[model samples]
Target: MSALGLKIIDESVQQANIWINEVDYRVGLVNKQRAYRLLRAVLHALRDQLTPDTAAHLSAQLPIFVRGIFYEGYNPSSMPAAIRDKDDFIARVVAIFGPEPPEDITGAIGGVFDVLDARLSPGEMAQLRGQMARDIRALFAD
Candidate 1:
Protein backbone atom coordinates (compact mmCIF):
# COMPACT_ATOMS: atom_id res chain seq x y z
CA MET A 1 0.00 0.00 0.00
CA SER A 2 3.04 2.24 0.28
CA ALA A 3 3.79 3.95 -2.97
CA LEU A 4 7.42 4.41 -1.91
CA GLY A 5 7.96 0.61 -1.88
CA LEU A 6 10.60 0.82 0.88
CA LYS A 7 8.76 -0.30 4.01
CA ILE A 8 10.63 1.69 6.63
CA ILE A 9 10.50 4.95 4.75
CA ASP A 10 6.86 4.34 3.88
CA GLU A 11 5.94 3.56 7.46
CA SER A 12 7.74 6.65 8.80
CA VAL A 13 6.01 8.85 6.27
CA GLN A 14 2.68 7.33 7.23
CA GLN A 15 3.37 8.07 10.89
CA ALA A 16 4.16 11.69 10.07
CA ASN A 17 0.98 11.93 8.04
CA ILE A 18 -0.99 10.60 10.96
CA TRP A 19 0.18 13.47 13.16
CA ILE A 20 -0.50 16.06 10.49
CA ASN A 21 -3.94 14.66 9.81
CA GLU A 22 -4.65 14.57 13.52
CA VAL A 23 -3.67 18.23 13.84
CA ASP A 24 -5.84 19.09 10.85
CA TYR A 25 -8.77 17.19 12.29
CA ARG A 26 -8.37 18.59 15.79
CA VAL A 27 -8.20 22.18 14.54
CA GLY A 28 -11.19 21.70 12.22
CA LEU A 29 -9.00 22.81 9.36
CA VAL A 30 -10.25 22.00 5.88
CA ASN A 31 -6.81 22.82 4.47
CA LYS A 32 -3.86 20.57 5.18
CA GLN A 33 -1.47 23.48 4.55
CA ARG A 34 -3.11 25.49 7.31
CA ALA A 35 -2.77 22.59 9.69
CA TYR A 36 0.90 22.30 8.75
CA ARG A 37 1.39 25.98 9.57
CA LEU A 38 -0.15 25.52 12.98
CA LEU A 39 1.93 22.44 13.74
CA ARG A 40 5.20 23.95 12.54
CA ALA A 41 4.59 27.19 14.38
CA VAL A 42 3.74 25.56 17.67
CA LEU A 43 6.55 23.05 17.40
CA HIS A 44 9.14 25.72 16.72
CA ALA A 45 7.86 28.05 19.43
CA LEU A 46 7.83 25.26 22.00
CA ARG A 47 11.26 23.99 20.95
CA ASP A 48 12.86 27.40 21.42
CA GLN A 49 11.43 27.68 24.91
CA LEU A 50 12.89 24.43 26.24
CA THR A 51 16.38 23.96 27.60
CA PRO A 52 18.66 22.54 24.92
CA ASP A 53 18.93 19.19 26.69
CA THR A 54 15.20 18.83 27.17
CA ALA A 55 14.55 19.92 23.61
CA ALA A 56 16.91 17.30 22.27
CA HIS A 57 15.30 14.58 24.36
CA LEU A 58 11.85 15.60 23.18
CA SER A 59 12.82 15.82 19.51
CA ALA A 60 14.43 12.39 19.69
CA GLN A 61 10.98 10.97 20.34
CA LEU A 62 9.32 12.70 17.39
CA PRO A 63 8.54 10.86 14.18
CA ILE A 64 11.27 11.08 11.47
CA PHE A 65 9.79 13.89 9.38
CA VAL A 66 8.25 15.61 12.34
CA ARG A 67 11.64 15.57 14.04
CA GLY A 68 13.11 17.36 11.05
CA ILE A 69 10.38 19.97 11.24
CA PHE A 70 10.99 20.35 14.96
CA TYR A 71 14.68 21.05 14.30
CA GLU A 72 14.35 23.12 11.14
CA GLY A 73 15.89 26.37 12.41
CA TYR A 74 17.35 25.16 15.67
CA ASN A 75 20.52 26.70 17.10
CA PRO A 76 21.34 25.16 20.44
CA SER A 77 23.87 27.85 21.33
CA SER A 78 21.22 30.57 21.16
CA MET A 79 18.40 28.41 22.31
CA PRO A 80 16.11 28.30 25.38
CA ALA A 81 15.46 31.87 24.33
CA ALA A 82 13.97 33.99 27.11
CA ILE A 83 10.39 33.15 26.20
CA ARG A 84 9.40 33.27 29.86
CA ASP A 85 5.62 33.74 29.57
CA LYS A 86 2.50 32.90 27.59
CA ASP A 87 2.07 36.18 25.72
CA ASP A 88 5.62 35.99 24.40
CA PHE A 89 4.98 32.43 23.26
CA ILE A 90 1.68 33.31 21.60
CA ALA A 91 3.29 36.30 19.95
CA ARG A 92 5.95 34.04 18.46
CA VAL A 93 3.28 31.72 17.04
CA VAL A 94 1.25 34.63 15.70
CA ALA A 95 4.34 35.97 13.94
CA ILE A 96 4.71 32.56 12.32
CA PHE A 97 1.08 32.56 11.16
CA GLY A 98 1.66 36.05 9.68
CA PRO A 99 -1.19 37.93 8.00
CA GLU A 100 -3.94 35.32 8.00
CA PRO A 101 -4.18 34.66 11.71
CA PRO A 102 -6.48 32.08 13.22
CA GLU A 103 -9.69 33.28 14.81
CA ASP A 104 -8.99 31.20 17.91
CA ILE A 105 -5.27 31.14 18.59
CA THR A 106 -5.75 29.46 21.94
CA GLY A 107 -7.87 26.75 20.36
CA ALA A 108 -5.32 26.24 17.59
CA ILE A 109 -2.45 25.96 20.06
CA GLY A 110 -4.46 23.77 22.44
CA GLY A 111 -5.38 21.56 19.51
CA VAL A 112 -1.70 20.83 18.76
CA PHE A 113 -1.06 20.06 22.42
CA ASP A 114 -4.09 17.76 22.44
CA VAL A 115 -2.79 15.71 19.51
CA LEU A 116 0.76 15.60 20.90
CA ASP A 117 -0.61 14.21 24.18
CA ALA A 118 -1.26 10.97 22.34
CA ARG A 119 2.02 10.92 20.43
CA LEU A 120 4.35 11.73 23.34
CA SER A 121 5.04 9.57 26.38
CA PRO A 122 3.05 10.87 29.32
CA GLY A 123 6.11 11.14 31.54
CA GLU A 124 8.08 13.08 28.94
CA MET A 125 5.13 15.34 28.26
CA ALA A 126 4.61 15.93 31.94
CA GLN A 127 8.22 16.88 32.50
CA LEU A 128 8.25 19.24 29.53
CA ARG A 129 4.97 20.81 30.66
CA GLY A 130 6.31 21.28 34.15
CA GLN A 131 9.37 23.15 32.91
CA MET A 132 7.32 25.78 31.11
CA ALA A 133 5.77 28.87 32.70
CA ARG A 134 2.34 28.37 34.23
CA ASP A 135 0.56 30.58 31.71
CA ILE A 136 2.21 28.75 28.83
CA ARG A 137 1.42 25.41 30.44
CA ALA A 138 -2.23 26.36 30.60
CA LEU A 139 -2.27 26.41 26.82
CA PHE A 140 -1.63 22.67 26.93
CA ALA A 141 -3.89 21.86 29.84
CA ASP A 142 -6.60 19.33 29.01
Candidate 2:
Protein backbone atom coordinates (compact mmCIF):
# COMPACT_ATOMS: atom_id res chain seq x y z
CA MET A 1 0.00 0.00 0.00
CA SER A 2 1.20 3.49 -0.73
CA ALA A 3 1.90 5.74 2.23
CA LEU A 4 -0.38 8.80 2.39
CA GLY A 5 2.51 11.14 3.05
CA LEU A 6 4.44 9.80 0.08
CA LYS A 7 1.42 10.19 -2.14
CA ILE A 8 0.99 13.81 -1.17
CA ILE A 9 4.67 14.59 -1.48
CA ASP A 10 4.93 12.82 -4.78
CA GLU A 11 1.95 14.64 -6.21
CA SER A 12 3.26 18.00 -5.05
CA VAL A 13 6.71 17.38 -6.46
CA GLN A 14 5.23 16.26 -9.77
CA GLN A 15 3.11 19.37 -9.97
CA ALA A 16 6.10 21.56 -9.24
CA ASN A 17 8.06 19.84 -11.98
CA ILE A 18 5.20 20.35 -14.39
CA TRP A 19 5.08 24.04 -13.59
CA ILE A 20 8.81 24.43 -14.07
CA ASN A 21 8.61 22.59 -17.35
CA GLU A 22 5.77 24.78 -18.47
CA VAL A 23 7.81 27.85 -17.65
CA ASP A 24 10.77 26.45 -19.51
CA TYR A 25 8.60 25.80 -22.53
CA ARG A 26 7.03 29.23 -22.44
CA VAL A 27 10.33 31.06 -22.08
CA GLY A 28 12.09 28.98 -24.77
CA LEU A 29 14.80 28.01 -22.31
CA VAL A 30 16.23 24.58 -21.61
CA ASN A 31 17.63 25.89 -18.33
CA LYS A 32 15.40 25.19 -15.34
CA GLN A 33 17.19 27.79 -13.20
CA ARG A 34 16.49 30.58 -15.70
CA ALA A 35 12.86 29.50 -15.90
CA TYR A 36 12.55 29.56 -12.12
CA ARG A 37 14.11 33.00 -11.83
CA LEU A 38 11.72 34.37 -14.46
CA LEU A 39 8.77 32.67 -12.81
CA ARG A 40 9.52 33.99 -9.32
CA ALA A 41 10.29 37.49 -10.52
CA VAL A 42 7.05 37.81 -12.47
CA LEU A 43 4.98 36.22 -9.70
CA HIS A 44 6.24 38.66 -7.10
CA ALA A 45 5.43 41.63 -9.33
CA LEU A 46 1.94 40.36 -10.08
CA ARG A 47 1.25 39.48 -6.46
CA ASP A 48 2.20 42.95 -5.25
CA GLN A 49 -0.37 44.51 -7.58
CA LEU A 50 -3.32 42.30 -6.68
CA THR A 51 -5.93 42.68 -4.00
CA PRO A 52 -5.83 39.95 -1.37
CA ASP A 53 -9.01 38.37 -2.67
CA THR A 54 -7.87 38.44 -6.29
CA ALA A 55 -4.45 37.17 -5.31
CA ALA A 56 -6.08 34.23 -3.55
CA HIS A 57 -8.18 33.54 -6.62
CA LEU A 58 -5.12 33.53 -8.87
CA SER A 59 -3.33 31.23 -6.45
CA ALA A 60 -6.19 28.75 -6.72
CA GLN A 61 -5.41 28.31 -10.42
CA LEU A 62 -1.73 27.58 -9.80
CA PRO A 63 -0.25 24.12 -9.26
CA ILE A 64 -0.23 23.16 -5.58
CA PHE A 65 3.53 23.57 -5.23
CA VAL A 66 3.56 26.76 -7.29
CA ARG A 67 0.87 28.31 -5.15
CA GLY A 68 3.38 28.55 -2.33
CA ILE A 69 5.80 30.34 -4.61
CA PHE A 70 3.06 32.74 -5.65
CA TYR A 71 2.42 33.74 -2.06
CA GLU A 72 5.99 33.71 -0.85
CA GLY A 73 6.73 36.81 1.23
CA TYR A 74 3.28 38.22 0.46
CA ASN A 75 2.06 41.02 2.66
CA PRO A 76 -1.51 41.77 1.71
CA SER A 77 -1.70 44.71 4.05
CA SER A 78 0.76 46.66 1.87
CA MET A 79 -0.27 45.44 -1.56
CA PRO A 80 -2.44 46.58 -4.46
CA ALA A 81 -0.25 49.61 -4.87
CA ALA A 82 -1.18 52.42 -7.25
CA ILE A 83 0.41 51.19 -10.44
CA ARG A 84 -1.52 52.90 -13.21
CA ASP A 85 1.56 53.40 -15.34
CA LYS A 86 3.30 50.77 -17.40
CA ASP A 87 6.76 52.01 -16.39
CA ASP A 88 5.76 51.71 -12.76
CA PHE A 89 4.60 48.13 -13.26
CA ILE A 90 7.69 47.31 -15.29
CA ALA A 91 9.93 48.89 -12.69
CA ARG A 92 8.38 46.78 -9.94
CA VAL A 93 8.98 43.63 -11.95
CA VAL A 94 12.53 44.69 -12.82
CA ALA A 95 13.44 45.37 -9.22
CA ILE A 96 12.55 41.80 -8.31
CA PHE A 97 15.33 40.58 -10.61
CA GLY A 98 17.98 42.28 -8.38
CA PRO A 99 20.61 44.93 -9.21
CA GLU A 100 21.29 43.79 -12.76
CA PRO A 101 17.81 43.32 -14.16
CA PRO A 102 17.34 41.62 -17.50
CA GLU A 103 17.41 43.82 -20.56
CA ASP A 104 14.39 42.18 -22.17
CA ILE A 105 12.08 42.86 -19.25
CA THR A 106 8.97 43.13 -21.40
CA GLY A 107 9.64 39.74 -22.92
CA ALA A 108 10.05 38.22 -19.47
CA ILE A 109 6.74 39.64 -18.30
CA GLY A 110 5.09 38.57 -21.54
CA GLY A 111 6.39 35.05 -21.11
CA VAL A 112 4.88 34.75 -17.65
CA PHE A 113 1.69 36.36 -18.93
CA ASP A 114 1.52 33.76 -21.66
CA VAL A 115 1.85 30.94 -19.14
CA LEU A 116 -0.88 32.41 -16.99
CA ASP A 117 -3.07 33.01 -20.00
CA ALA A 118 -2.71 29.41 -21.06
CA ARG A 119 -3.40 28.05 -17.56
CA LEU A 120 -6.28 30.42 -16.81
CA SER A 121 -9.57 31.07 -18.52
CA PRO A 122 -10.00 33.89 -21.04
CA GLY A 123 -12.29 35.86 -18.75
CA GLU A 124 -10.20 35.23 -15.66
CA MET A 125 -7.04 36.25 -17.47
CA ALA A 126 -8.76 39.37 -18.74
CA GLN A 127 -9.83 40.27 -15.22
CA LEU A 128 -6.27 40.22 -14.02
CA ARG A 129 -4.98 41.96 -17.13
CA GLY A 130 -7.60 44.65 -16.78
CA GLN A 131 -6.20 45.45 -13.38
CA MET A 132 -3.01 46.62 -15.02
CA ALA A 133 -2.30 49.78 -17.02
CA ARG A 134 -2.87 49.89 -20.78
CA ASP A 135 0.77 49.26 -21.70
CA ILE A 136 0.95 46.46 -19.22
CA ARG A 137 -2.16 44.94 -20.74
CA ALA A 138 -0.41 44.96 -24.11
CA LEU A 139 2.09 42.47 -22.68
CA PHE A 140 -0.66 39.91 -22.92
CA ALA A 141 -1.56 41.03 -26.43
CA ASP A 142 1.75 39.72 -27.71
Candidate 3:
Protein backbone atom coordinates (compact mmCIF):
# COMPACT_ATOMS: atom_id res chain seq x y z
CA MET A 1 0.00 0.00 0.00
CA SER A 2 1.10 3.56 -0.65
CA ALA A 3 1.77 6.06 2.11
CA LEU A 4 -1.62 7.49 1.32
CA GLY A 5 -3.09 4.03 1.78
CA LEU A 6 -4.99 4.40 -1.47
CA LYS A 7 -4.19 2.18 -4.42
CA ILE A 8 -6.23 4.33 -6.73
CA ILE A 9 -4.19 7.44 -5.90
CA ASP A 10 -0.94 5.57 -6.41
CA GLU A 11 -2.10 4.18 -9.71
CA SER A 12 -3.22 7.61 -10.83
CA VAL A 13 0.16 9.10 -9.94
CA GLN A 14 1.94 6.36 -11.80
CA GLN A 15 -0.27 6.81 -14.83
CA ALA A 16 0.17 10.55 -14.81
CA ASN A 17 3.94 10.15 -14.66
CA ILE A 18 3.88 7.72 -17.54
CA TRP A 19 1.90 10.24 -19.52
CA ILE A 20 4.30 13.08 -18.75
CA ASN A 21 7.29 10.91 -19.54
CA GLU A 22 5.79 9.82 -22.85
CA VAL A 23 5.13 13.43 -23.76
CA ASP A 24 8.72 14.36 -22.89
CA TYR A 25 10.01 11.48 -24.96
CA ARG A 26 7.83 12.27 -27.96
CA VAL A 27 8.59 16.00 -27.82
CA GLY A 28 12.34 15.53 -27.26
CA LEU A 29 12.21 17.74 -24.21
CA VAL A 30 14.86 17.32 -21.54
CA ASN A 31 12.79 19.15 -18.97
CA LYS A 32 9.81 17.44 -17.39
CA GLN A 33 8.47 20.85 -16.40
CA ARG A 34 8.37 21.86 -20.05
CA ALA A 35 6.67 18.60 -20.87
CA TYR A 36 4.13 19.27 -18.15
CA ARG A 37 3.51 22.78 -19.44
CA LEU A 38 3.01 21.50 -22.94
CA LEU A 39 0.71 18.76 -21.73
CA ARG A 40 -1.40 21.10 -19.65
CA ALA A 41 -1.62 23.69 -22.39
CA VAL A 42 -2.59 21.16 -25.02
CA LEU A 43 -5.18 19.58 -22.74
CA HIS A 44 -6.74 22.91 -21.90
CA ALA A 45 -6.84 23.98 -25.52
CA LEU A 46 -8.56 20.76 -26.56
CA ARG A 47 -10.88 20.71 -23.57
CA ASP A 48 -12.04 24.25 -24.20
CA GLN A 49 -12.83 23.35 -27.76
CA LEU A 50 -15.10 20.50 -26.68
CA THR A 51 -18.66 20.75 -25.51
CA PRO A 52 -19.12 20.33 -21.77
CA ASP A 53 -20.59 16.88 -22.20
CA THR A 54 -17.82 15.86 -24.52
CA ALA A 55 -15.24 17.36 -22.22
CA ALA A 56 -16.59 15.32 -19.33
CA HIS A 57 -16.56 12.21 -21.46
CA LEU A 58 -12.92 12.74 -22.25
CA SER A 59 -12.11 13.48 -18.64
CA ALA A 60 -13.71 10.23 -17.61
CA GLN A 61 -11.08 8.40 -19.61
CA LEU A 62 -8.15 10.22 -18.02
CA PRO A 63 -6.19 9.06 -15.01
CA ILE A 64 -7.54 10.66 -11.83
CA PHE A 65 -4.63 13.08 -11.44
CA VAL A 66 -4.51 13.87 -15.15
CA ARG A 67 -8.24 14.38 -15.04
CA GLY A 68 -7.61 17.17 -12.55
CA ILE A 69 -5.12 18.72 -14.92
CA PHE A 70 -7.68 18.42 -17.71
CA TYR A 71 -10.25 20.28 -15.63
CA GLU A 72 -7.95 22.91 -14.15
CA GLY A 73 -9.42 26.39 -14.53
CA TYR A 74 -12.04 24.96 -16.86
CA ASN A 75 -15.10 27.14 -17.30
CA PRO A 76 -17.67 24.93 -18.91
CA SER A 77 -19.92 27.87 -19.59
CA SER A 78 -17.42 29.22 -22.12
CA MET A 79 -16.56 25.86 -23.48
CA PRO A 80 -16.33 24.70 -27.03
CA ALA A 81 -14.74 28.13 -27.40
CA ALA A 82 -14.95 29.16 -31.01
CA ILE A 83 -11.50 27.86 -31.78
CA ARG A 84 -12.47 26.99 -35.34
CA ASP A 85 -8.95 26.60 -36.77
CA LYS A 86 -5.47 25.40 -35.93
CA ASP A 87 -4.05 28.87 -35.59
CA ASP A 88 -6.67 29.83 -33.05
CA PHE A 89 -6.09 26.64 -31.08
CA ILE A 90 -2.33 27.06 -31.17
CA ALA A 91 -2.71 30.68 -30.20
CA ARG A 92 -4.67 29.66 -27.12
CA VAL A 93 -2.02 27.17 -26.02
CA VAL A 94 0.75 29.70 -26.68
CA ALA A 95 -1.10 32.34 -24.71
CA ILE A 96 -0.63 30.21 -21.61
CA PHE A 97 3.17 30.33 -21.92
CA GLY A 98 3.19 34.12 -22.31
CA PRO A 99 6.24 35.51 -24.16
CA GLU A 100 9.41 33.47 -24.78
CA PRO A 101 7.41 30.35 -25.42
CA PRO A 102 8.90 26.94 -26.19
CA GLU A 103 10.96 26.55 -29.38
CA ASP A 104 8.66 23.96 -30.95
CA ILE A 105 5.28 24.53 -29.37
CA THR A 106 3.33 22.85 -32.15
CA GLY A 107 5.51 19.78 -32.14
CA ALA A 108 5.42 19.66 -28.38
CA ILE A 109 1.64 19.94 -28.34
CA GLY A 110 1.50 17.26 -31.00
CA GLY A 111 3.49 15.07 -28.66
CA VAL A 112 0.84 15.53 -26.03
CA PHE A 113 -1.79 14.67 -28.63
CA ASP A 114 0.20 11.60 -29.52
CA VAL A 115 0.20 10.55 -25.89
CA LEU A 116 -3.53 11.05 -25.81
CA ASP A 117 -3.94 8.97 -28.93
CA ALA A 118 -1.83 6.16 -27.53
CA ARG A 119 -3.59 6.15 -24.20
CA LEU A 120 -7.24 6.88 -24.89
CA SER A 121 -9.66 4.54 -26.60
CA PRO A 122 -9.95 4.79 -30.37
CA GLY A 123 -13.63 5.65 -30.09
CA GLU A 124 -12.88 8.45 -27.67
CA MET A 125 -10.07 9.72 -29.86
CA ALA A 126 -12.40 9.79 -32.84
CA GLN A 127 -15.02 11.66 -30.86
CA LEU A 128 -12.41 14.15 -29.69
CA ARG A 129 -11.21 14.61 -33.25
CA GLY A 130 -14.74 15.07 -34.46
CA GLN A 131 -15.06 17.98 -32.07
CA MET A 132 -11.97 19.70 -33.45
CA ALA A 133 -11.60 21.85 -36.54
CA ARG A 134 -9.96 20.39 -39.64
CA ASP A 135 -6.64 22.10 -39.12
CA ILE A 136 -6.54 21.12 -35.48
CA ARG A 137 -7.55 17.60 -36.43
CA ALA A 138 -4.44 17.40 -38.61
CA LEU A 139 -2.34 17.50 -35.45
CA PHE A 140 -3.78 14.14 -34.45
CA ALA A 141 -3.15 12.59 -37.85
CA ASP A 142 -0.91 9.53 -38.00
Candidate 4:
Protein backbone atom coordinates (compact mmCIF):
# COMPACT_ATOMS: atom_id res chain seq x y z
CA MET A 1 0.00 0.00 0.00
CA SER A 2 1.15 3.53 -0.62
CA ALA A 3 2.16 5.46 2.47
CA LEU A 4 -0.54 8.04 1.84
CA GLY A 5 -3.07 5.29 1.33
CA LEU A 6 -1.93 3.72 4.55
CA LYS A 7 -2.19 7.01 6.40
CA ILE A 8 -5.62 7.65 4.91
CA ILE A 9 -6.75 4.24 6.05
CA ASP A 10 -5.36 4.86 9.49
CA GLU A 11 -6.96 8.28 9.76
CA SER A 12 -10.22 6.91 8.41
CA VAL A 13 -10.22 4.21 11.04
CA GLN A 14 -9.73 6.78 13.73
CA GLN A 15 -12.50 8.92 12.29
CA ALA A 16 -14.82 5.94 12.05
CA ASN A 17 -14.19 5.06 15.67
CA ILE A 18 -15.09 8.55 16.72
CA TRP A 19 -18.28 8.37 14.67
CA ILE A 20 -19.22 5.01 16.10
CA ASN A 21 -18.80 6.29 19.62
CA GLU A 22 -20.99 9.27 18.92
CA VAL A 23 -23.68 7.10 17.37
CA ASP A 24 -23.59 4.79 20.35
CA TYR A 25 -23.78 7.65 22.81
CA ARG A 26 -26.44 9.66 21.05
CA VAL A 27 -28.59 7.00 19.40
CA GLY A 28 -27.76 3.95 21.47
CA LEU A 29 -26.43 2.26 18.37
CA VAL A 30 -23.03 0.66 18.55
CA ASN A 31 -21.44 -0.79 15.43
CA LYS A 32 -17.75 -0.16 15.87
CA GLN A 33 -16.86 -3.70 14.86
CA ARG A 34 -18.88 -3.48 11.68
CA ALA A 35 -17.49 -0.06 10.84
CA TYR A 36 -13.97 -1.35 11.24
CA ARG A 37 -14.73 -4.26 9.00
CA LEU A 38 -16.09 -1.95 6.29
CA LEU A 39 -13.06 0.28 6.52
CA ARG A 40 -10.79 -2.70 6.12
CA ALA A 41 -12.76 -3.87 3.14
CA VAL A 42 -12.49 -0.53 1.41
CA LEU A 43 -8.80 -0.16 2.13
CA HIS A 44 -8.05 -3.63 0.89
CA ALA A 45 -10.04 -3.02 -2.26
CA LEU A 46 -8.19 0.24 -2.87
CA ARG A 47 -4.79 -1.36 -2.39
CA ASP A 48 -5.61 -4.26 -4.62
CA GLN A 49 -6.98 -2.08 -7.39
CA LEU A 50 -4.13 0.40 -7.63
CA THR A 51 -0.92 -0.26 -9.55
CA PRO A 52 2.39 0.18 -7.77
CA ASP A 53 3.06 3.48 -9.53
CA THR A 54 -0.35 4.90 -8.70
CA ALA A 55 -0.07 3.75 -5.14
CA ALA A 56 3.29 5.45 -4.75
CA HIS A 57 2.01 8.69 -6.24
CA LEU A 58 -1.05 8.70 -4.01
CA SER A 59 1.04 7.90 -0.95
CA ALA A 60 3.17 10.97 -1.56
CA GLN A 61 0.19 13.30 -1.97
CA LEU A 62 -1.99 12.07 0.90
CA PRO A 63 0.05 13.67 3.66
CA ILE A 64 -0.34 17.10 2.11
CA PHE A 65 -4.13 16.76 2.08
CA VAL A 66 -4.10 15.42 5.59
CA ARG A 67 -1.87 18.28 6.73
CA GLY A 68 -4.24 20.75 5.14
CA ILE A 69 -7.13 19.24 7.04
CA PHE A 70 -5.14 19.55 10.26
CA TYR A 71 -4.04 23.07 9.47
CA GLU A 72 -7.72 24.07 9.35
CA GLY A 73 -7.71 23.20 13.06
CA TYR A 74 -10.12 20.33 12.54
CA ASN A 75 -10.32 18.08 15.55
CA PRO A 76 -10.50 14.38 14.92
CA SER A 77 -12.87 13.98 17.81
CA SER A 78 -15.42 16.20 16.14
CA MET A 79 -15.50 14.17 12.95
CA PRO A 80 -18.30 11.94 14.07
CA ALA A 81 -20.69 14.81 14.67
CA ALA A 82 -19.66 16.50 11.44
CA ILE A 83 -19.92 13.42 9.24
CA ARG A 84 -23.52 12.36 9.49
CA ASP A 85 -23.49 9.64 6.85
CA LYS A 86 -21.34 6.82 5.58
CA ASP A 87 -21.43 8.02 1.95
CA ASP A 88 -19.97 11.38 2.92
CA PHE A 89 -17.16 9.66 4.72
CA ILE A 90 -16.59 7.45 1.69
CA ALA A 91 -16.46 10.52 -0.57
CA ARG A 92 -13.48 11.71 1.43
CA VAL A 93 -11.80 8.39 0.97
CA VAL A 94 -12.51 8.45 -2.75
CA ALA A 95 -11.13 11.96 -3.02
CA ILE A 96 -7.73 10.63 -2.06
CA PHE A 97 -7.70 8.77 -5.37
CA GLY A 98 -7.93 12.08 -7.22
CA PRO A 99 -10.82 13.28 -9.36
CA GLU A 100 -10.08 10.89 -12.20
CA PRO A 101 -8.52 7.54 -11.59
CA PRO A 102 -7.44 5.57 -14.68
CA GLU A 103 -10.38 4.11 -16.55
CA ASP A 104 -9.24 0.52 -16.20
CA ILE A 105 -8.71 0.94 -12.50
CA THR A 106 -12.04 2.65 -12.08
CA GLY A 107 -13.72 -0.25 -13.89
CA ALA A 108 -11.89 -2.83 -11.83
CA ILE A 109 -12.88 -1.08 -8.65
CA GLY A 110 -16.49 -1.00 -9.75
CA GLY A 111 -16.32 -4.71 -10.51
CA VAL A 112 -14.77 -5.53 -7.18
CA PHE A 113 -17.34 -3.60 -5.21
CA ASP A 114 -20.18 -4.92 -7.31
CA VAL A 115 -19.13 -8.48 -6.73
CA LEU A 116 -18.55 -7.79 -3.07
CA ASP A 117 -21.88 -6.13 -2.56
CA ALA A 118 -23.69 -8.85 -4.42
CA ARG A 119 -22.01 -11.60 -2.45
CA LEU A 120 -22.48 -10.06 0.96
CA SER A 121 -25.15 -8.35 2.93
CA PRO A 122 -24.51 -4.74 3.79
CA GLY A 123 -24.86 -5.69 7.45
CA GLU A 124 -22.32 -8.47 7.04
CA MET A 125 -19.27 -6.30 6.47
CA ALA A 126 -16.95 -9.14 7.39
CA GLN A 127 -18.16 -11.09 4.38
CA LEU A 128 -16.40 -8.62 2.07
CA ARG A 129 -13.33 -8.68 4.29
CA GLY A 130 -12.82 -12.36 3.60
CA GLN A 131 -13.53 -11.91 -0.08
CA MET A 132 -11.03 -9.07 -0.26
CA ALA A 133 -8.42 -11.23 1.45
CA ARG A 134 -9.05 -14.05 -0.98
CA ASP A 135 -8.88 -11.71 -3.94
CA ILE A 136 -5.60 -10.21 -2.79
CA ARG A 137 -4.09 -13.62 -2.27
CA ALA A 138 -5.22 -14.72 -5.70
CA LEU A 139 -3.78 -11.61 -7.30
CA PHE A 140 -0.41 -12.24 -5.70
CA ALA A 141 -0.46 -15.88 -6.70
CA ASP A 142 -0.16 -14.90 -10.36
**How many collisions per candidate?**
0, 0, 0, 1
lDDT of 3 by residue, 55-121 (tens): 9999999999999999999999987788979999889999875665578777877888999999999
- Cα lDDT for residue 72, candidate 1: 92
User: What C-alpha lDDT do the candidate models reach, one value each?
Assistant: 0.89, 0.80, 0.88, 0.38
Better of 2 and 3 by TM-score: 3
Off by over 4 Å in 3: none
List the lowest-lDDT window of 10 residues for candidate 3.
96-105
Better model by lDDT: candidate 1 vs candidate 4? 1
Can you give the lDDT of residue 119 in candidate 2? 80
lDDT of 4: 0.38
Where is model 2 more than 4 Å wrong at Cα? 1-5, 99-101
Question: Per-residue CA lDDT of candidate 1, range 28-70, in tens?
Answer: 9877888888899999999998889999889888998999989
- Quote the positional error of residue 29 for candidate 3 in Å: 0.9
- Which residue pairs in candidate 1 collide? none
TM-score of each: 0.94, 0.86, 0.94, 0.26
Clashing pairs in 2: none
